[model samples]
Target chain A: MYRSKPWRIFQLSGFGSPEEEGERIRFLLEHGETGFIMEHDRNTGDHLYNVDHPEVMARREDVGLTGATIQSVRDYETVLKGIPIESTYGHPGGGVVQHGPYALACYWTVARRRGIDLGKLPGTGQSDFFLTYLGCVTKQQVPTQTGLRFNADIIEFCAEHMPHWVPVSIAGYNGADTGLNAYQELGAVFANAVEYLDEIQRRGNISIVDAAKGVGGVSFRVGMDLFEDVAKLRAGRKMWAELLAKRYNINDDKAQRLRIHSLTAGSMMMYPQPLNNLVRGTIMALAGVLGGTQSLGVSGYDEALSIPSEHAHQMSLRIQQILQNETNLCAVADPMGGSYFIETLTAQVEEKAWEFFDEIEAHGGFLNTLDSGWLHQVAHKNQFEEQASIDDGSKIIVGLNAFADDVTPFDIDGFKSSSSEWKHALERLNRVKSERSAKLAAEKMRDLEAACRTDTNIMPAMMEAMDAEVTMGEIGDVFRNVFGDWQTPISV
Target chain B: MSALGKKILLAKTGLDGHWRGVSLVEKRLQEAGFLVVMIGMATPDEIVSAAVEQDVDLVGLNVGGHIEVVHKTVDQLNERMVGVPVFAGGAIAPWAKKELEDRHIEVYPPGSSLEDIVDAAFRLCRINVKASTLKIEAQINPKYSADGAKP
Candidate 1:
């Protein structure tokens, strides 16, 4: 079954200046990567701030460490300069919910400027709550209700205009990596899907089937628990199909089919004897392929230290290539489907997941759980247990807890972020601020803010704001003032 | 007051908020009877002010970004409060760890155990590590380490 449909070899690639990010992306594409993911700087992109924002300025040296510093449409242009956006399955990074609109608008604006039709563009905007609210909680973000509204609006906007785009892909990967168990990840993901579907149904403008199709392209984290994770993917697909058919009572084949993207779990990568992570990544990637993922991203071996170095990134791509070309693992879809052990595990996971789903519903659904710190509690409990096992020697991670010594000749001192990134990004921010039509930008920003204040969908105004050259920090200002910030339930 | 009940101030220097690492450490410290005042993702000024205001026994910095930011925060804290001991843990690289260690700050990068961190806290708080270990042993079983004997 898998032989017919090849998995897309996607890699999360970006760092330093926009030009450098472009060069790196170009290198990945040239080296057999089927698609590319643009990783924006977590300090800026995740927080929706510009380089000059006080919070960013306070830590200016970290500007381009996590990812590239893309503050405007012009920066997006610089990042996507040589890449063929029309063909490549680009993931213009907006993993955070509040930053989703800005990231998508900037990418779409760049495509439009290149005379590419928005309808034909194929890409994904993450806008994941797990990333924004739970896994990597930003210093500030719009409250859950506002985040729900923004995501619903994005789904609606995508349904009307950008039919090809996967808007708001709910990533269970972030939640799992943060500490959610397998069944909890499944339960929380479906709980999130139900929230989105229920809201769409209430709106009545977009059909539930279309909304389901848009949200069905979810991602999961495949980790060292090879069999269980593989079973999770299978169970997830079956659960998604049953969910649509049972809850919504609608079952178009396209709507029922769950498109999965799997990333190797970064948290599982060990800091010591970093080369061991290559084996870990390969095994995790194999799990994803065997589980019949539509796309896969193998985590870099140096993941524990920092973002992928060039060699680490290349090694990740090569692992996927070897599996795709040499192993013949993709020759059969759901190869372990009929195995007695696999089938039993899959059924067990599905049952446990539904029980978890009921627990979420009993506690007032996904957003409520996040708001009340219920979800964080669950993740934290599991994290503690896992850590305890490792601490007590019940769980032995080679080269870390068990085989604790290594004398390798490989000089692996993880990638360091460029010091000049802040200086350059600040210059670019100033240039954009000075070069743009100040009056038009101000007017458009006001329009965006007004849209945020009202019940109107915020996408069109956001697009206009991007076109008007409004910087990311300005958009964040509007969000902070209009929507207020989320009271983070857990004390991080 | 209990030997392990020394107050500690913990803060993250960067905006990236993957809290699993720090949260785990905080939980371990708290379980070991440390009064952890967690200030999540604070600026250098906020960290220094909190360190002074809280009047904690030790300061724990969770470093998640460039070493410069963490270094600056540590330098400011040292300048303002001369004798306060500081230890850090997170995704700190080898070079960065060396730099931090050079400045007399205890560096615990990823994979450092909770036991080690707790031991460091005991040491920084001026509590006898040997006494703390004996106390833990006594708590686990009174017959063990009652006379402060090594297990």
Candidate 2:
């Protein structure tokens, strides 16, 4: 009697102001979405800085374009103000690696303030290495080793307290979009997982079972590789089970179970005839479901134009909803599990992923490659070659390269003219700086700086900073002093 | 040669560091006898500052992020570089292609050939060209990028 839960209808809903963010989240949940993801502004969240910082102040308007400007746990309180945190499966934004601890700690602090037990809270934190290192390379971030320590600390913290929480999820979506094909995405994710598991093992504090649970939930991108991407997801589950059982010798099936979240490839949404992207979105969502993903987010039909328009966001949710309600996709597990082409691709994706895993290991594992920019180069090489193919007439993208004539009169100018939210974010950022307790915040930051210098777990100190209402820019300053900027191995 | 009179500045406006677009374009431009000054991800201010400091002949921007950022760079450059023309490319969609062209700034979206881009580079710098059969076809009708394809 397996009543399969319909794939968690999730979307990365946010941007600009806290109220606007709340409105959007409520909109998604009201419409049909079962889960919510708070996306913090990249300028602030990714850099762990507030808008008052010089780099941010230089381009103040760019702040909310990426996400809402959440300066404190108080802001998280505003965003999740009336929402039932206990019932909702939430993803509180910490998309960048360095920002992970602060993002999660802030969310946890808010939940704790409500007297909600940390042990019972259900949500996930994303301090994705691939997103940090590959996708949206931040202007400033901690070194790979430091990022690893931060992630490891989160894993340990969650395992002990927030049992239902997924501490850190590595997003293969970033790597795939950067140029890793199907198998490479899987191999790199597992390789990155070992970095955390191995670090925790060396510490000898937590059970491997607990560590596996914290790291087991991972995300990958599904693209037009259709069968291949679907196969990638199925392969992801079996590979995760195998890796944990074989490498860590974990005996619990609960620990070995791999929970997958798939974000339809943002790069796949072509800019021309943007409506064609709706079909692309539908196909990608179908692939995600076929791959047995526990959760899915469809890239907007207008993804190439700008951040998803309100209509585009609704269409993405509608596409997923249609698949869930009309297609009867939820009745089976690994729906395409045993088909010949799927099986072969699954095996190939799994096998090639292992080869890629070995390649990363040869470069001294995932974090080492990122630190040295080895993986970045591999992604770049593929990116160049693909473009070369389009240039040479070897490849053809419909709206871009062929049959581009469209009859529709509708325009997708994207979110080009929105500036009011950016202005509000700056104002709110300033207000937090003035209203927060000054002395206690400084003390907590000093402790955070000390923790960063030493190899001690930084999450607890980070949570203290949030509790004392320490701002994003203050934490960013501490990181600048401690880790300095990654020279960024990536160059075109 | 350090004093090679032909230098083109290459930069990306967004934080996205996918270098393939710039690298391929760089390779094509370099092959056509130009030195590409790769100023990887710079602000519009930085781009202008580099244009003056480097004394480059032409500017090529790989517009990966919000095209508005690229437009800002172009608008700022319009006043700064009177004779020095600018050409751009990347995940630039068709909608932006028209706006960029309206400003007399040459726009090359995903499907543009290396030949076309190189030719545009020559045109921007006022260089001589053969204007052969293939070049004519490319200028008249460019090929499209394959679905879900990236460079």
Candidate 3:
């Protein structure tokens, strides 16, 4: 333990029952994981719907397939009860903008109960627009404007309370995976962050400087493009610093220095020789590490399947650990700062990114692109074109289109699915209905709706609603009343 | 074939909107001579209603979330109508794929060939799957100032 100079190798893991999911998290940490990510079931979490909601009730069995079913803070406490959250950096999966506040508040609320002050807690939450607007466009979400407000609120909340927390990380990684090439990823992230910073300044509560620093920690997707991805990462840091100086005119060291976390692109993993994805993972992880990232989450070999199996999750962690320990990658910082190709690519990414950023601003900014379905089309155009290229063999995916054979000895199927996860969710849903106070839940929801309508920050009301046992369905009703559903342009 | 203009109800079972696989197929199915009713994203109820109201002969499910979610949609489809062939795609992990197949549902992952899907559409639509492959693919200009929204 003399040299704790290791970057925490993090992996997203959690599916099935809360106990089963918690066991997997504990197992990863026991092996070598320095950090953990708690993934909530998407069907319930992303839509902010309870199991009884007509849509959720239709397919109640799909409830916990993606991740554990956690309806209340009590459910969160069950999943994280034994984990040393204070010691280990914890990413409570709040990947959706609408869902993130509830997820983070629940995690922080759990920590508070364990006597952990909010200030000492260290972790980042992802409310990635790339995921919501581009890659995995949810069935329903607040309009882009409401989403910006939510992210801005979180940034300010963390600024005021939890200095160690990175609030609402902008995950360009989601966009890149969805098919925005390297430069587009760079540009979109800056454009997205501008939305956040501008919103914060408009609120006039927090300093633009502190909000910039708080939201500056972003995440990117680094895949097989070694030099290009690495340059993107390095360029991201300098671009962020430059953005701060240009916009807020604050040269505060922390505000300028951008911190980054990277996840290997899930789309990069090929289904044809599943074992080859291990090599793909290594290559992508190398791209991230070489790109000067502060943290990394490599895609598992069987990523195209369900959530990572235990072995797959472990191997993902081990891939990063090997890179950290055996490769001597961490011995220096920004090691690829001045290669001719890298420098040129970095500049190219920055220049092109600024162009896209200008485009987003011209379109009336990030929210406008989202609201008008402009950004969705941009991502759609990229996605279909990328697929067409792959189909026609114009863009080669090794082992997929080109080297379609496998002589490897090992066998790997994607993670096995379970129908039981859904059963557990229904049981929990029934338990919550009978256990909670009906009157208190109603009052809290009313308060939340009022708070959402007024200029007041909704997190405090959300925390209270959650504490009073308000179900996600009730909260969703409030959202529908206040923000209404976004009319999406794409038929996704 | 007697079913010359049989309707094919195509809908996304999950809110996760990935249009490439669904949209391309919708266009191809329509071009290959099927009535492709593209209901963007719907819960099971909406899908069933559209399927019945349109009197569609076959259902295509674009699944983007947990497979369990899509299964409920399929179950509703079966419950609402009889003998309607169902096919699905998108993020259907091996296990989910297997389950869908077990229900005699045709499953396509993302990388499945467009020809194969068009061929399946022909089988379901009861038409000679025409040889005309869908040639429309999006092209990106280097100087696109803003994104263009389209249906």
Candidate 4:
């Protein structure tokens, strides 16, 4: 157990404007957050669209509600203005697989402009297939094979240049929160990791050990199932170590060490009696801490109602502060390691997870299940059963189902984005377009499109494209023309 | 007891595509016998056009972003498809909920019961049902009650 290492207090923060998102990040840092994550506006970031895209234009008011409207490297500069990228750990807002290269490139480009060395910058990028294809299915995205290429490219690029960066964190949090049960989440996550490792091996640019180190820093979701979730995390580490050692045959201890980041499940945060979620967040965070997570992000109390308000965000930070400072949680790793029940449960979870992994492999691996909707069906069935259990009173959610009456005067209305966010974002987009060299941008865009069509690693061209001020939509257009949209198996 | 051919058009107002809430609602609505047309993540103009073209009795908006977008869609529907009611459910903030309620659009935030949503659909669509005909026969008769009591 890595008891000597301190768990990073990572929190997801963004919304309204780049300036506002920067302010919020600064606020969280001031309130004892060890790491910060920049969340991009879903309308633009997740879909790789700009503010002027027809789909975004129709919902202009939604431009900055979910996150900051960052369309180019210029917006990344504003969002990261005073943050110490070299010393501080950061996640630069690329949870969606298709947008990972663009987001990482923009963040790296801004750092390069500021004279920061890529090798010294410590951070992670989320190019999660679970998020891209299964969790939040976009209407248009590059196919899974293209996504795999992008991720493999990122892994190789990071191994060569950005030594301190965790490239493409496979987030099982998205899958679990979507509906996969504990063991299913574990199995699917490892299966997803195998996809990355197998791709890296086929590419043969980076060593398998180094690639495992890059892909080992995965994320999981911790819900109200306290002991079970703790066991899941424990099982996750053991399984990762076993998979690398047994399957790959060459395991450096550092490469085999599975670094976990646990986020409190947002779906577990109930809407009514929002304040009650504070306790829920605490308990879930405790599970993460007890399970020996390397990093953690607690869902806000108002998660079910709206995006986190500033106060709600502060409360999340406060909960972690109390857990870290007062509870003596950091003094030991794997505190429940010796408990008979915990040990049994951890072994049981690992066994079930391997079974699920075998099932996914039988169905032609994880990516195949995603393409054929087999994984989606598994998640959908779990969701239906969970909903039925809650409806029938078998699962007693305290504030929601059991104790439904609330008389507290908390007055929590949740955060609402400013109305001027769209107008401001539009102005910034126009300014960037007008100030940059149009011919140079067009040439770089063409080069990027050409790179996408070949076996070439797209990162270098992507970095060049970012420096040339190519917007997200342009890169997206290149991908759409070359790779085309994925055929989503499930109907929304 | 039959929905009497009542139809409801459903669409997400924003591009955000977490479909769990919307999918569950669609399943419940279909189980209740209303013909559901799910055109996911549609634009305001497209939603209005579909409602009018489909001649739906009600519109269901699965909102996951700023309420202003949903308000715009509702305005378009009211202007083009007159006499059609709209209801919405998602992670709506209280202020947005109030804004939608003021427009006479029922807003169901998270934790809203599916039964209540199904009931609201029936009422809003003006489906008149006598008490005798309201009962839905069980698809499978169980030998034991849910609590293990013999039936």
Local accuracy of candidate 3 as per-residue lDDT tens digits, A299-413: 8887765568888888898898888788777777778777888899889988888899898888888777766667756765677667767777898888777988778786565
| Residue lDDT tens for model 1, A11-61 | 998999999899999999999998899998888888888898888899988
Candidate 4, A296: how far from true, in Å? 0.4
Runs with alpha carbons beyond 4 Å of true place in candidate 4? A1-3, B1-4, B128-151
Q: How do the residues A1-492 of candidate 2 rate in per-residue lDDT, one tens digit apiece?
A: 014578898999887787778888888898899999998776667777676666565455466765788888878989997899898999998888877887888999998899999999998999999988776676678888778888888999888888999999889998998888888889999999999999999988898889999999999998987898888988898899999888988869888889889999887888778889999999988888888888999988877666776788899899998998887677777677678988998888899999999988987788878777677667765776676577566788886777878987977776552545556766776777688778888899999999988978788899899899988777878888998877676552
Q: Identify the superior model by DockQ, candidate 1 or candidate 4.
A: 4
Query: Measured by TM-score, how close is model 3 to the native structure?
Result: 0.92
Instruction: Quantify all predictions' global Cα lDDT against the true fold.
Output: 0.89, 0.79, 0.79, 0.88
For model 4 the local lDDT of residue B136 reads 38
lDDT of 1 at A23: 92
Q: Write the per-residue lDDT of candidate 1 for residues B1-151, one digit (tens) a residue.
A: 4336699999998988888889888777777777888999988999999999988889999988898888888789888998999999898877788888998999988878777888898888888763235332112211123222223
Residues B99-145 of candidate 3: C-alpha lDDT, one tens digit per residue: 88998999988677666777787787676644444454344422233
In candidate 2, the residue pairs with backbone N, CA or C atoms under 3 Å apart (3 or more residues apart, or in different chains) clash, namely A50-A473, A383-B151, A387-B151, A396-B145, A396-B146, A397-B145, A397-B146, A397-B147, A401-B144
Docking class of 3: acceptable
Better of 1 and 2 by lDDT: 1
- Fraction of true contacts retained by every candidate, in order, equals 0.58, 0.17, 0.49, 0.56
